[model samples]
Target: MPVEEHDPFEDQFASALRQAGGTFESHRLDLAARGETRGRKIRRRRAAIAGGVTGVALVGLGGALVLPGIQTDGGRRHSVAGSPSAPPTPAASPTRPSAMSADDVVRTLERLLPKGKFSGEEGRGTGEQLPPYARVVYDDGKGKAAVAVMVDRVRPGGSQALETTACPDKVFVPYDACTSGRLADGSTLMILQGYEYPDRRVDTKLWSAELVTPKGQHISVQEWNAPAEKGAPVSRSRPPLSPDQLKMLAGAAAWRSVADAIPADPRVPTAEPSRSQGVPGGSVSATLATLLPKGAEVVKKGVADPGFGYVVIDDGKGASMVQVNVQADMSGLANQLFGSGSRTLPDGTRVATHQGPGDKGGRGVVMWTVDTMRPDGRRVVISAFNSGTQHTPATREAPALTPKQMETIATSERWFSRD
Candidate 1:
């Protein structure tokens, strides 16, 4: 299934948390818990709207929305944009690096850009209210566009680093084009050419380059066709910076220096854990493929995430989408999710099913879902949609899988077994 779109509620909650911050450590812990919950909700809702099940899926860059911080394995974190709210004062450390000045950040950005007239410049220095970042409206004699750069740290070789450099799934995020690969310096880079809106409600283009180094420095550079990321008319057909320009800007050494100067959170562990640790054995897509009923021709498959996978199939009638999420330790959410309408099996597994119109603005689309959870808190959710994608009109009357088939798949023992 397509990854869930950003939740407005989570954004509001995060903003509220930042504003009410006491210590950075406390805020980070609270936000991390909230983020995990929001992530689960997003996955569940996205699959439900597109097909039927709800669970945690991979994170997608829906509309390129700026997150306060991107959390990774080993408690590493990075910011995509600097916040305006006042930050908690850092405890004095003898080795604490001097903070970068806000002016220095803006100057570096201006210098990196091609010859252009800049206005509405804004910046936040390292170790300030938030991570270091620079934003400006630039006129390159062609048209005015908004450009921004943010620098921080990530867990080297962690899932967040991989996700940042991976192209978003077209099913969830419709983009013109995207490319990702590793640089000579062992840094992964991704350049995305997409619109500011996933639905293309507006033509304003949003192009971005994200680079994550082996040493954990992360640099993100974004450009918009309009003079602002949102709430502005398109000033040009596209952003000013070409893909090559964006790569150069994101790989600049200055950003690395800025990243290095940021103080490390004491709560984060020094030893990084393997990205695959604690995740389900094998890929979700691989396991889903084994569980699929006969005669369904797979057309496309979603990238594997910790607990999520999806596939588009055709049974010679029309294209349909099926997605599954396998999450562990979800017993805490059972009462809230299953409710009284759910049924209990002899094995003490809870099961719930639903059929409804898709909530993702797709026309004439229907989603069917079967959700199941074992007594051990191992939850498996499977959903199928009548359409190949959630954003498009329905191509079939119903999903390829019936409610009974989905229920069987959701309750299969293969989800928890390595074999």
Candidate 2:
């Protein structure tokens, strides 16, 4: 007889937790001879709570990860590994890379990597001191995506290595990874996820890593991308000194040096929020009739998202975001930037309007930003990019924000005013 198939709910539950950035080892599940179906539903509910589900009223829609718990708009809850409510506002400026030891970093990375059947090679090389850390590179030839680990070199034991895991797999294994599509400029993009063992934190840390092509330049997954859509797009600097240079810089302890020095996530480069203005306890929403020009009507608001809110606003002209993440909803705004609305792509992906067209045939300007503090205080940013262009499905087609623009938006004084 064929082996019995397990309940799909349990499998989906484990998968969601992994995707939501949770680490649930296999041993944690106790389904042995137990009512498997009940266990699966319970598992999903737990994952939803852990990831902070933003009630997505899923109408007949299907896109990757358009599931129950994950944030449909790319942002996720940045909570401590175990807590439910907003992660404690970490003490230091959150959003920097972690510092660790070379040996520990590599060993931790290896443990996190998925096992077997992969066809890539793993080689290690050191790098020159790259500030807060030294560097080690890991590349298993499968496209240009490679891993660049940064460590704190000054500390005798500091050293770190970044590597890639296989993609499109079924179970949650160490080092499993994937990437965003290619940009207009001929570059392949990939995202890496792995367990990090830093000197400061004892528990395994899960972090996102972005690998950019051509010369294999690597930056913290969080730092490589800018925080605002209006800001100048950031370009990767030349590939840092080769692995040889890394070793020379840190000497025998380069890995440790780099690992220990990997800085915490950077501050939201845009106009930073004042300590006086804290994250709000609730969200805001408004009817389309109240805010948009005539013909434009407000569709239902997406479930409240702490980092960003999604509303379906429409006019015969088309619908797009009037404001994003600025409020729980779009109740207060003196000026309506037609450009600032929400739009749904042919593929069914919903994007907040920034500095682009209001919608097909729509017009106006809208601006906003998203800054998330990781459980450990590291930050992730997504800002609006202003420009005139129709929203299209192509990733390369999106207009980019300039550096000066980024600074201006970062410094904007009236982001949270209740007017």
Candidate 3:
């Protein structure tokens, strides 16, 4: 049976959540069920909370994860069982590495953490159905918190590696602070202080550190103010670990050995170049900037991504966020995305408009959208939010651009130009 196509608006909304590290587990299940019907995977790293619908090539602790380009082929590793309190040490020889057991993975995390009482411990070691992870509910005297860590690998200098370290745009992600830099050992590290919910509906704070070594060791550490990532009361004003502590935990050397023991995915060739499979995000943002209505001051812009771009604008009324997605060969989805309300242009183009409440749980937020498709199956979707981000309360009565203005921007010939 063919998988039914999802509503395009929902997909775009979920993409924003994924990039912002917002929780949307149902979306993940939907994407899994849809399977290959979804085209190329756009990977993202979640430093704090995890959710949103995208191809999660790797799993991480506390549901927070790193995104790699290709899916693992479920390769197996030789597991040597050990005690949770005292995991078996790997052999000295890198040539003859010993696999860590699930217990070993958990024990390593426990040992590296500061003095704390640990419970609800769980872990997946190398050769598991999913990637390796270790999570525990830790109480460091002040409060009980959830701390998790995951180790994986990515292609060195690949798009996955770069994305893992890049700071998310505040226009999409409402983080308090974020920093990314290279270490003395050529490792890239990023620490993010953000909320578990993009909307800040709850005050649960989330902080995380991501470290990618020169040899492709991908480590992510996440901690939340509550005992769990979600569905829990905030146990403290902030997460248990400070930014520096999170960084130290992620940079621990023990994880690299665990990464080494994990077997490689047979499907992802090692030499694959780190390039986008869609229209470069820089091109989209540049084009969108050029098409903005006169005198609209650009407050912020999104990171250079492929096929997606966003900008925050304030036309004197208040801050508003405008985002666009440029996709090629989307004709297969036209019938599902467009309906009777859509109209056809004289040049064989299709146009659809929508005005509705924001789907991301922000209070009093509205979304205005213009979706367009050319005869050649190229898709350009433009959406504006009343708030600077979809997850925030409305800052104005409506989006900066009226529906007609959005339509004009969506249909402009400037979008058709080559990057």
* Per-residue lDDT over 127-189 for candidate 1, one digit per residue giving the tens place of the 0 to 100 score: 653456677789999999888776767679865567667776777566788999999999999
CA lDDT for candidate 1: 0.65
Pitting candidate 2 against candidate 3, the one with the higher TM-score is 3
Report the poorest 10 consecutive residues by lDDT, candidate 3.
34-43
- Runs in model 2 deviating more than 4 A are 1-144, 150-275, 278-281, 284-310, 324-419
Model 2 TM-score (2 dp)? 0.26
Q: What is the TM-score of each candidate against the true structure?
A: 0.76, 0.26, 0.76
Candidate 2 yields a Cα-based lDDT of 0.26
- Per-candidate total of colliding backbone pairs: 3, 75, 1
Candidate 1, residue 230: Cα displacement in angstroms equals 3.0
